[model samples]
Target: MAGVTAAVSARLKADEARRPGFYAAGSGPLPQVRGSTLPVMELALQITLIVTSVLVVLLVLLHVQRRILLTMTGLASALRNSG
Candidate 1:
């Protein structure tokens, strides 16, 4: 095993000295790139939030209107009974 290791090391050293430009040495491989859909994801989230906020506001306004109508009806009844 040690003899095989020595042979491989010697071979590698000889190869490295002989052909320095064999494996595209200095420039390296072209860079790989990947893109994410973060902007689309954020836009979707913002749209959802705006829609939910508008729905909540509409529901709150509906509740307030219902309460106001009830109060007005009660006041009208009280006035009719007193008069």
Candidate 2:
């Protein structure tokens, strides 16, 4: 079983190396750092987080506005009926 597993692993590694930009470095099975790719990945992650945060804030504000409008509407109706 071990021998078969090793054979398959080796074949997979060979296939991965054949692809473009497959950098295998360090003492691990994966690349530790491939040129300037890490920074690009970080930037992408940051941008995604910022976009998500802004959307959440906007949605919360909209909900608050809707609740305020509903409360005002109820108060106005009560005042009219009282008079």
| Residue clash pairs of candidate 1 | none
What would the C-alpha RMSD of candidate 1 be, to one decimal place? 12.7
User: Per model, how many backbone clashes are there?
Assistant: 0, 0
In model 2, how large is the Cα lDDT of residue 45?
A: 100
Candidate 2 residue-wise lDDT, 1-83, digit = tens: 99999898787778767886674343256645557677898999999999999999999999999999999999999999999
Q: Candidate 2 regions off by >4 Å?
A: 1-35
Looking at candidate 1, what is the lDDT of residue 3?
Answer: 100
Could you say which candidate leads in lDDT?
Answer: 2
Of the candidates shown, which would achieve the greatest TM-score relative to the real structure?
2
Tell me which residue pairs clash in candidate 2. Answer: none
- Whole-model lDDT values for every prediction: 0.80, 0.84
- Segments in model 1 whose C-alpha atoms lie over 4 Å from true places: 1-35
Native-to-model Cα distance after best TM-score fit, residue 10 in candidate 1, in Å:
29
